[model samples]
Target: MPAIILDDISFSYSSSPLLDHVSLRVGDGERACLIGPNGCGKTTLLRIVTGRLLPDRGTVTCAGDAGPRLIPDTEGSGGSVGEYLDASLRPLRVLFTRFEEITARISEGGGDRLAREYDRLLAQMTARDVWSLDARVDETLAGLGLSELTGPGRGRSLGSLSPGQRGRLRLAATLLVRPETLILDEPTNHLDAGAVGFLARTVNHWHGPVLMASHDRAFIEDTATVTYDMDIDVWRALARAEGADEFTGLHRCAGNYSDYLEEKRRARARHSELHAAQQAEKRGLREHRQAGARIARGGVRLARAEGMAKKYFADRAAATATRRTRNDDRRLEDLSRQEVRKPRGYELSFPMNPVPVRPGSALSARRVAVRRRLASTSFDLARGEHLLVTGSNGAGKTTLLSWIATGKPPAGAQASGTIASDRPIGFVPQHLPRAGDPGFAEEIWLRGIGELGRGILHPSMWTVPVPELSAGNQRRAQLAMALAGRPPVLVIDEPTNYLDLDTMEALEEALHRWTGTLVVASHDRWLIDHWHGRGLHLEPA
Candidate 1:
């Protein structure tokens, strides 16, 4: 039996439909990845499939008799990591509670009706190996490098931990559940490179199916057996408009993430070529039809010879022909069914032309640092060169970026070093304040929907209230805002945190072609390694 199945699922929030008659299935032992840009309804679709959210129309079925375990993107009803981890092992907790209850009933001289139930519960606990539950949990935590979550700092609230820590904690707890099938959402968001590697290996070795939605390219390459992409539908709709039959909906690409990209690229190119040919054919037909109309307009001799009403009947026939021409494309109806306009993809071009630099470095810092955060650092960055600052969580990577971007120490940091250059700097921070005014989305977006589509955040999300979008999309929005007015010196802190794979690739290309100085602070090994410029690795003191 399939691990999960969804048929004719349609879900909508507000007037815009997110998922329209979308159907998906994952078979036994199949690792299927649902990938699209942020807010493309991947999360919503996962929720529906996992039974966390019901579709307005359709049926979702899962073969997991005990129900599949879902690892949500966000932290659950907030608690200490220990409490959260413990809560995940609900069956174990229930077994302990039932055992205590049975003992109490027997001691109180309860009747045989209770005795029968008590005996059965005891046997159940033994069979399930409930006694080793705590040991399993401990082992899981240790394996995930999250033993500290249950150690001295176990009392720490989940929210207090860094995003990466909380994410690892969730993964550790979920793994302990030992569900037959797993539903993971953005599983790589907060994971560092090491944890991602562990997760990839673990998932690959698992016995059951794994359904995940993520924008992590490296993770997907390591883990996915197949990829499900809804964005193909959008592209198909474009092709269908041009009377294309080859590409029309969600595509399941075989192999891993890299293979998926290559396959999709080939398919898209082929579809475009077919569409172009169809457009030419349609144009010729229309021209031929126009010639027939011209003949009718000239008052054809046949009209008078056969007494045919050329003005009336011929015009009606021409109208019928035009209707047939318009309806010839069967897939155009797919584009007409949705209220949400498909976001258009655009090529983003940054406009920053800096004057020629002298023989000296573009930026030079003697010794400046964030107070109690970063050690006094010194580095000289030449013009048009790239620099990456890498460190683990709480290693003051952001602090270094801030100091360089502003050419002064951050508020809490002290500086004594002299940094050169008066070039304008574009700084994208790790955290972005939410756009509270909903109209802000409209104002900035209405002016740049085309450009917005070029980045990770789609243009369709522009009209929606900005506060409601994911943290990653919000971050992308800010980055878009920053890049709109490109500065000569670009400084970014963790630019890859919440972006989809395509957006990351696009930004990488942009950064490579930039003619100005660039400095980035990120845990994204792929991005950092690809830059291959200079490195500044920080270790916690």
Candidate 2:
């Protein structure tokens, strides 16, 4: 049975229609992904289906015997596990409280005997296995990697945990309830790659239906049996083939993302060719009347036949000559321009000194150790060099970047050292702050840049709010802000997170032109391969 269904759903925020009569259904145990460019309504659609936001028009229905039930959000509730569990099982809590009251009344006695009566009450509670509640809470906590949350007196607040940890805890609480349907929105955002993989595995093993909206391509590819690409194409063809509203099959490409792109290019080329052919036939039909008119006029008068024929032939010859001349002109122009100036790829390298003495190191680290959730490790970075830091999820790459930026020495530094240059430094963090009050954020960022007095700032940058800017533009703005400090060194973390291919390439070109020292932490293989720099490999200890 379908887990959830949307029939002719239409949603509009303000005057703009985000979804246009969209309809889709997810089946039991089906894993699906919703993908699209930013601002493409993926999140809005997810919210609508998850019942967080209501649709402007149309009906959303759920199948199976049980209908929709609200699942409580477990984060930042300032409630203990027991409290949450009790809230979830409110009817059971009420029944248990009634039983306790009845038992207390039955044990009513007098004097010192009342003390023994209290002990007897405690023994009765133990016999009734009331302590099992704590054990159950501990089990849930341990499963969610919150083993420290064990014990009734260990007053560990959920607020003390990081957002990622809280997110995990929320998922754990929901899973413990064993809901029939699950809807996750950008659940992987706060999770490391390892946690993402674990989530994918969990989804695959789940008996209930799963519907998720995510930007993480790997997670989608691993988990989704159906994918809805909003603002591009819906999977109606797959649904039709499956003989159901829900697609039961996964989209399997014979090769990688590049291969899929190549297939799309071929399909688009065929479509264009067919369109061009149809246009040519239409043009030929439109020109047919002129040719027939000339022929008819020539045939009507014999005296003018020879002259008309000559004129017709001359017209044809002139047209042919004109075509040839235009073709020749175009060919010559193409050849000339082809040889004129090809777009040169940027060449990035450290500035060379005339004397050519051994280039002094920009920064250096010796026997540096890093501590992360997954493991502990150490490494070194040399000056006048670029190093790619590569690792799997939970390998502490982000932590390392933070350590470098803060200038806090790494853990277990047997022979740790940091060499500083007179030049200033710039650091672009992985996550750009969300656009709230764009005017205020932009002004603050620009003022910081102005203080460095190192580079020219563009004036057009002020027009659009920071939130309105594209991801690539946001990263560029952050980079500009960092460079504004005129730091001799720059460290950028995950610079290509939301960037498209073209923007990613453009960023690489810009980075190549930069004269300052750079340290980049990224997972993009293309960025690593195109980078003309050394690499610092970190592994789990």
Candidate 3:
């Protein structure tokens, strides 16, 4: 049996239905990925599978009575690192204690039942490698780059750690728990290259099923065995129905991210061809019907003319019109019943507004440093130049960017820096500040994203609360707000965090052509590989 199964699941947050009869399954040793644009119910479907939120319709079934376990992306509350680690190993500890008790009872020769229980406990311990549990825990922490926290930093409070560190810590604990079935939501969101590689390896070697929702293309390609695209439109489904594949909500593709792309491309080509042919047929039928009507009118006019010749001509014309009308009506009915749906098209062009600034140094910084957070650094950015910042987690990428854009150090940290900018600077950080009453969605509509934004964010979502919006949508809205002012110098940290491939590619194209100075910090391997810019590498202080 499959480890997890979702059949005909339907869910909605309001009148706007998010998921409609979506279904998927993951068997033992299979790794499945959910991919789509932002706010397309990837997270929502995962939530349903994990039992965090119940579906409004349909049912979720697991191989066993227990449901799948989720590896959360954030540590919810404050605690010492040591306490959190101990909590993760609590299940093994309890089992060990039970094993000891059973052994004692068997030694006392209590009964046959006690002996049987001892054997069962022994088997469980061996399978889980309880004797080497400590070593396994240590290895997991090291692999996820959490060794420092488990060593000298273990006594520190979790609140002192950066967001990335906290997320890594949570991932480490989940790995140690070794749940039978694993479900992850954007597991690579806060991971660096090394951590992401570690996760991919773990998932590749997993004994049970794994399901994840991720925007990391490289990771998905590396680990996914089957891909489930959750953002299918009815029109797209209709187009696919013209061929062998037919689905309403979820479209399943075999193999990894690359295979999925190729299949989608071919499907789109077929849809376009079919749509064009259908359109031509419809046009021809309409013309024939109009011609029939004209003939009928001519017959009426001829019948009014005086004489036997006119009467005979009117009869012939009327018969011909009647025959044509019947044929046109039959063909039109057939065409209507078998009509092809128009394929959904994407308009991916996002042209940047011209920056109004004199040609010179756009930004200049000297010996910028935040105490205990960032190492001293300096750079000169000219107009139309792009600068890419590369670093591992906790290497002060965010600190450097905040300082560059605002010339102010982070809270509780002192900084010494000399910075100047000739024009206005726009900054889009990884974590945005608390949104106000109008919310990010409403703000985006008010400030208008032109043609490109509409493609990513549908008009129905304009009234959704900012907090209710998906992470990717929030990021898109933040970007739109920043671009509305048209700053000559733009600084963005981890701009591709929650953006899907479509939006990411569009943003890359816009940035490539924009005539402005750019300072970008990102850990996305795909983006870094394709970036055409000067590089600045940072190390942890």
Please name the candidate that would achieve the greatest lDDT relative to the true structure.
3
Tens-digit per-residue lDDT, 1-541, candidate 2: 4487778788888797788777777888777676555676777877777677899888877653221244455665776655654565443344456556655765674456555665665654443344464455556556556566566523656566677766766665554444557777776665655556666676787665677777665666567777655633323332332344543212323333345445444544544454455456445544554454454343444335576676776566556555555554554454333221122222222222223223566665544554343244444444445667878656767766766665765556332334343245567788874533221365554343232222222344544456666665566566666665456677888977766443454567767666556788987655665678878767764
**Superposed Cα deviation of residue 292, candidate 1 (Å):** 5.7
Worst 10 residues of 1 by lDDT: 334-343
lDDT of 1 by residue, 1-541 (tens): 4387778788889888888777777887789999887778888887776677888988888776322353433355576766776667776678779888988988999899789988887866664457787786666666666667666677888778876777677777666665666788887766667677777777887656688988777788878899998876545655555546545226677889889878876765665555565566656666766665565444554356434555566666667656654654333344333222333453335555545544557788777555567766778888778888888876778777777767776664464666675467777878763443221355564443245434445767665445566776666666656555556678888787666666677677777776778888888766765666888887763
- lDDT-wise, the better of 1 and 3 is 3
lDDT of 2: 0.57
Ranking by lDDT, best first?
A: 3, 1, 2
TM-score versus the correct structure, for each prediction: 0.72, 0.58, 0.77
Q: What residue runs in model 2 are displaced by over 4 Å at the alpha carbon? A: 64-68, 89-140, 152-162, 233-364, 368-386, 390-415, 419-427, 431-462, 465-473, 479-490, 496-518, 522-541
In model 3, which regions exceed 4 Å deviation? Answer: 12-17, 52-57, 64-88, 94-127, 148-170, 234-246, 272-277, 299-316, 319-348, 352-385, 394-396, 399-426, 433-474, 485-489, 513-517
Tell me the deviation in Å of residue 311 in model 2. Answer: 13
Question: RMSD, model 2, all Cα superposed?
Answer: 12.4
Whichever of 2 and 3 has more lDDT, that candidate is 3
